[model samples]
Target: MALTYTLDNARSLIAVALIIFISWLLSENKKRFPFFLTIGAIAVQAGLVLLLFAIPNSQAVLSGVTAAVDGLADASDRGAQFVFGYLGGGQSPFATVPEGGQLPFIFGFRVLPLILVISGLSALLWHWNILKWITRLFGLLFEKTMGLGGASALAVAANIFMGMVESPIVIRAYLDRLSRSEIFLMMVVGLATVAGSTMVAYAVILGPVLPNAAGHVLVASIISAPAGILLARIMIPEERKATELDYEVTLKYENSMDAITRGVQDGVMVAVNVAAFIIVFVAFVGIVNNLLGLAPPLNGEPVTLQSLFGYVFAPVAYIIGIPWEEAHAGGNILGVKLFLTEFIAYIDLGNIPADAMSERTRMILTYAICGFANVASVGIMTGGMTVLMPERRSEILNLAWKALIPGFMATLMTAAIVAALPAQLFGG
Candidate 1:
C-alpha cells in the first residue's frame, strides 16, 4: 500500500514535469540546450511550494487577505443598502419589503452589483493615483528581480488589477517594440491569473463555498506570476535586445469624471458579457449532455457529457491531491472551467456538496481554475491585442494556440505546489 501510494505521487510529479518540459521545448525559438531555463522554471515552481511550507506564518498572509476581501464585501453591501434602500436587499433589507409588495428580482442580482461598486471604487483609487503608485512598486520589483523590460514589467504588475489586454495599454507605446517572447509572456500571465476588477465577484461566489478562499485566490495569482514569466521565457527565449530601465508612473486619465464614467462603462460591458456568455454556454452544455444521455449506454446506465469529463479529468484531479473517491467530482469542475468559463465552474463549485471535496483539494482547485484561459479567451486576446497594436495581429493570431498550453500549464504548476504541500501550510 505504501509503495503504491509513493508511486502514485511520483507519477503525478513526473507527469507535470514532462508537461512543462514539452511545453518549453515546443515553444522555444532558440534550439540550444535549455539547461538553465528548465532548471530556473523548476526552481521557481518548487520555490513557491517551499515558501508556503517553510514560512512559519504563511497562514497569516492568507488570513489578512481574507479579512480584506470580507471587509470589501461588507463595505459594498453597506453602500448597496444606502443607494437602493430596502429594494437593494441589503442586510436583512428583504424582510421589510412590505408583505405582498412584489418582491424584487433577486436571482443572479446580489453578487453582480458588487462589480459595479468595485469598479467605481477602483476608478476612484486610480484617479487619486493610489493604484498607479502600487503598480509602480510592483513593476519595479519585477523589473529588478526578474530582469524584465520596463513595459513588460509594468504590464505584468498592472495585470494584478486590470485585464491582460487592458494592462498592456499601460505601456501601449512600447507594444510595437516588444519582443515576441515578451508578448507571449503577457498573454500567458493574463490567462493564468485573474484581474482585480472581477476578484470581488469571484470572492462572493467562492467565499461561501471554500473557507479563506478569497485569500487563497489572491495568493494563487501572485505565486503564479513568477511561474508564468519563467515558462514564457523557457518557451520563447528572448531573441531581441531587452529594454532599458525607464520606469515612468503616470495616470493618463483625461479627468476624474471621465475615469469614473469609463470605468462604469467597462464594468457594465463586462457584466453583460458575463451574463450572456453564461446563459449561452450553459444552455449549449445542457443540450450536449441531453443528447448524449439519449444514446445507448455501455454499463446499463445512460452516459452523459459530464460523466465523460469527470472520467477524462479524474486522474488530473487525483494528481492534484484530491481524494480518490472525489477525484472525478473535482475534475468535472476543472474540465468545465477549461471548456466554459471560470465563473460558471465557480458557481458549480459553490453548489457542490461540502462533503464531496476535502479542504486541501478544494483550495488547490480554487487556485488552479482561477484564470481566463478557456477557448473563448483566445478570441478575446486576439481581438484586444489587434486593437492595441494592429501590426502584431498576425503574430498574435498565430501564437494564440501555442500560448494556451503554457497558460494552462502555469495554473497546473500552481496546483501542483498546493497539492505537494502539507494541508496545515494553507490552514486547511
Candidate 2:
C-alpha cells in the first residue's frame, strides 16, 4: 500500500465512499438502489484510469491522443492567426514590456476560435462515421455493464463528445420513451461532461498550468460519464427497465461540407453564448464583490463572494486531496464552477500564481472543474429537453432540480477518483 499509493490517496477514496452514501441517502427509492450498477460504473472508471495511467503502453497511447488534440488546437490557432493577425498570435507591431516577450493573447481573437474549428472538424469526423463507431463501442460498454437501454446508453456515450442537448438529437425518436430515471440520468450526465468543441478550448487555456491538459480533460469527461451514471442511479434508481436496450444512431448529415457548415453554425452559437456569459457573469460577480466589500473585514481582508464560497467548499477541497493550506483557493474555484461557469473557473485557475498550489493539487483541480455542471446548465438541459419532447416539458422542469446536485457531484466524483490514485500516475 505504501509503495503503490500514498496516505493522502486514502482520504480521496473515503471521499468517494461519502459521495456514494450521500447519493444513496438522497435516493428517491433507497430500497431499490442498484448496487451492482454502482459497482460496474465505478469499475469502468477505475479500469480506464489504470489503462491510461497505470500501464506504460497505455500511457504512451494516451500521450499520443493528447498530442493529437494539442496539434488540433495548434491548427485552430493557425486559422485564428490568419484571420485576426497579431491578436491571434501573428507578428506584432507593438513593443513588449520585456524585450522579445510575446504580445498578450486576446481571448476572443485567439481562444474562442478553436470552438469553430474543432466543432467543424468533429462534424466532419461524424460524417465519415468515425465518431459513430467510437460512440457505439462506448455505448455497448455502458449498455452491457450498467443495464442502460440502448438509446440512453448511446446518448450517455455521446455526451462524452456532444453537448447535453445535442446528444439527445441522436436519439430524438426515443425522447418520449425514456423512463423518468433515464431522463434524469440524461440530464445529469449531460451536465457532467463537456462538449467536444469546448474541450480543446479549455485545454488551450490551462496548457501552461497542467501538463497534457487536453488528455486530462478528455479523460475527465470519460470518467465523469460513469460517475454521473452511478450517482444518478443512486439518487433516482430505475423505476422501470430502460426501454432503449436496442438502439442505433439516427443522426445524420449530407456531405462533409454540409457537416462542416452546420457544425460551424452550431459552434458560433456556443461561442457567442460563452462570450456573453463570461462578460455578464464577471461583471455580476464584480458588482456582488463590491457589495460584499462593504462588509466588515475578516482576518485583515474584506469578505467577498470568493471568500464566502471558499469557506463553504474548503472542506470539500481538503477531502479531495488538496492540502488544507490551499483549500480556500481550491474551494473558490469549485464555487465559481458550480455557480457561474467552469470556463470562468478554468480562467481563474490560469490566473493563480504557480507557487500558490502544488502541481498535484492543480491537476486535481483541472480534472475537478472539467465539466459543464453549473446552475446555468440546468436551464440549458431543461430547455433543450423540452424542445425535443414538448409533452414532457412540465416533468422535465420538475426533474431539473433533482439532476443539479448529481451533475455537480459527478465531477467531484471524478476528482475523488483522481485524488485516490498515486501522484505518480499523473507524473507528479
Candidate 3:
C-alpha cells in the first residue's frame, strides 16, 4: 500500500486544533495557559504515532511485542483449557461431531483468564524491577517536559501499566501533600489509559477487526500518557510547580511468589467486575431499548439506546476522520465506551459486520475508545483517591469530577492525531 491522505485526514488536523481550543476555553485560569508546553505535548504524541506506524524499524519492534503477547494469550488459553475443558477451547470429549470441527470460545473461560495470567506476570516483572525502570524513564520525561513533580510524574507513568487506584499507591507518601494540579493530572492519566493486564483482553476482543491489535492497544496506552498530561494542565493549570521530588516506586512485594499470589488475587476482582459489568450493563441497555421501541421508530428503524448515542456523537466521530456515512456507527461505539466501558465498546466494534465500515474507520475508532474514561471510572478514581488521602477527601472528590472532561478528551486527542496520518501507515 502507498502512503496517502484523504480529505478526512486533513479535517482531523482541524479537529485537533478544535479539541485544544476547547480545552483552553475550559481552563481554570485561561490567562495561565502554557502555549509552548501544549505544542510540545502534541508533538510528542505525533512523534510517537509516526515512529510506531510510519517507521519500519519501530513497526518491527511493535510486531515483536505483539507476537510475544499473542504467545502469552495462547499460554493463558491452555491453562483455561485445562481448567474448563471443552468450554475453554479444549478438544471436545464427544466423538459424534465431525473431525476437525472447532468448539465455541467462551469469553469467561478463555479471554477472562488471560487477565489473571497477565496480572501475575506483570507483578513478576515489577518485582524484577523491569517495569520500575521503564516507568522511571517515562516519569523523568513527564517531569521535565510537563513540569510535573517527581511523584506525580511517576504515578502518571505507572498508570500506563497499573490500574487507576493501583498507580497512586506508588506515590502514596506524597498523596496527602500533592498539589491539586498534580492530583488532577494523576486522575486524568489514570482515566485516559487502560491497565497493561487488561490490555490483553482488549486486544483479544479487537483482534479480528484489527491487525496487530496488541500493538495498537499498547501504543494507545503509552501515547495517551502525554496527551492526558497536556489536557490536564490545560484544564487545571498550576500556579506553582511541585517541589518535593520522590521518584522511587513505593509499591513492594515480599518476593516473586508473593507478587504473583497477590496479583492473581487482584486480577480475580477485576475479572469478576468485568464479567458482572458486561452482564448488568448489556441487560440495562436491552431493557431501555425495548422501552424505547414501544414509543416510535425513527427513520424506518426502531429507536434504541445505541441509535440515540449515535445521533449525539456522530458529529464527533466525523470530526475525528470517520467518514460521515460511517460516523454514526463509530459514534455509537464511542458513546457505548463513554457510558458503559471500553471493553464493551470493543466487543461491539468486533460484532459489527467486517465489511460495514472501512478498515481505517475501524482503526480510528479502535484508537479513539482505547481508554478507561467513562461514567463508572469517575467514581472509581474518586473512591480510590479518597482511600489514599482520606484527609483530602473533599479535594479528591472535587477534582475527580472535573478530571472526566480532560480525561475523556485526552484519548480523543490521541485518535485525532492518529487520524491526521495516512491510514496505510496503520496497515489499514
* Per-residue alpha-carbon lDDT of candidate 2 for residues 370-425, written as tens digits (9 for 90 to 100): 88889877877787789889999899999998888888888998998889888877
Name the 10 consecutive residues with the lowest summed lDDT in model 3. 240-249
TM agreement with the true structure for every prediction = 0.87, 0.96, 0.96
Residue 14 in model 3: lDDT:
84
Please provide, for model 3 over 219-294, each residue's C-alpha lDDT reduced to its tens digit, 9 standing for 90 to 100: 9998888989988888888777684655553788899999999889878877887788888888999999889999
- Model 2 misplaced regions, further than 4 Å: 1-4, 97-101, 245-249
**Candidate 2 — which pairs collide?**
149-244, 150-244, 150-245
TM-score, candidate number 3 = 0.96
Whichever of 1 and 3 has more TM-score, that candidate is 3
| Local distance difference test values of all predictions, in order | 0.73, 0.86, 0.86
Local lDDT at 17 for model 1: 75
Looking at model 1, residue 4 earns an lDDT score of 22
Candidate 1 structure lDDT:
0.73
